[model samples]
Target: MRFPFARVVSLVVAVALLLSAVSGFFALFTARWRVASLPGTQQVANHTFTEQIIVGEYRTCVTLRRETPATNDSDVVQVRREENCYNTFPVNLFWSSRLRDVSTGEKAYFIGVCWINRDRVARVLGIPEDVPMQSLWKRQCFGVRSASVGTQAVAAAMAVIGGAVLIFDRNDKERPYRGMILIAGLTAALSLVPLVIWFGVVKKPGFDVGPSLRLAGFTWGIHLASFLALTLLHFCHSRSEMARYSGPPIDREVVTTQTADRLTPTQARAGQAAEGFARLESQA
Candidate 1:
């Protein structure tokens, strides 16, 4: 049993898209898990609670001091003092600010960290017994989630289009169907858009880093491979079409010489007479 070249190309494209989709799903899963594991609150001092500090590229420690109201009408307040616990050689991304609690009307400060090797830093710093160190901040995880979701969506589209092309398009002669080639080229070009955004816009130093970076990289690689396969298939189909239309091969020099010899009526008659004489000689 034989399959058309167009069908084979479409099948390959479908497989490639499927792999890219799988990678994207894995990346999405990892991002969600990391975000869920972060601590919601931290104990700043005795009998007090505040939002947990987010740790990113830089390590930090916060100390909270509670203050009593001076007058009966005054409200209680908490003071926060932050110190750089340890600075890593390679700086990562971090965001820190105070947020007001909607329910209790208390202010809490949180720190978010991204792309830092936290375990190694913890071991090296020998964190103090009192200072709480948790790797809770990851600003880039959200970007990873966005990129992964976009990748999955694009891959799914590619798979559907490729499968349709494989099923509906058939080659009539030497070349794959022109419609199939056109659709494949369009799909390959469209697929590249998400990858460009992922690498150029979404995958940033502070926003998408760490383990998510590895997953994003793998997803991008699959996408690139799929595009290249589609391009090669299109090139092959074009070559086949050209060959089909160009006509049968002949010795150009021999044909040209024979035609040139027949340009004059005298040469043509002399050649005919030579052929008749050679036939008579053979018969004798």
Candidate 2:
């Protein structure tokens, strides 16, 4: 039995694209885009909390860890970790300082650790100045975050559509592959936009805090993979199309060439008589 090799290959490519596209959306939900470990400790009452900040497209979180001193008898220490997360944007996009807590008269301070140096994070967050905080949450930063979210969402959506189209249009007969390739191109572009925006934003001078803030998160890697897959798929389709259109001519009957090269003398004479009869019949 012969296997349907082309169909199987198409299905595999579509499945891969679908999975990567779905995973790309995790960038919006995952809080691992940019990471930094601050140098100093925060003293809240009796506990001194060491800080690490994690920024995502939509939300940013800080993990504060405190360790109890080991006793003389035993070297074991007790450690407690606390995490606080806040929306990247406030109730209003313009608001920069304190984030409103659920309970009355309680507030959580929001700071952009992306710009703060490791040693300066403590001082920056400690001070209650409105002006510098406003500078940190610049309108441009908010715009970039918003744009990244939008492009990533659209890229994932386009990838889903492309996969569905590939699955449904099984036979290249309806010629929807062109549309599929176009969708792939769109998906690639959309996926690329977020990567460019975030990479550039993170590499900007201010975000380069001491100890080097790393963009070593899963979301960025996923986005990069999705972009590469979509791009490679697009070019593959284009090359296949070019080959299909520019391929050798289809088989056709040529009595003159065939009779001369492939027929016996008796067969050649019969072919000539048949051609003459066919012409006569058409004239009649």
- Which regions in candidate 1 have their CA more than 4 angstroms from the true location? 4-7, 32-152, 167-208, 246-284
Candidate 2: segments with Cα more than 4 A from true spot: 1-3, 39-46, 67-78, 90-136, 139-142, 172-176, 204-284
Ten-residue stretch with the least lDDT total in model 1: 31-40
Model 2 TM-score, all chains together? 0.57
**Model 2 pairs whose backbones collide:** none
Write candidate 2's Cα lDDT for 76-152 as tens digits.
Answer: 88888766565654546554555333213256565444443322333323322221323334533657767877887
Backbone clashes under 3 angstroms, per model: 6, 0
Residue 239 error, candidate 2, Å:
8.7
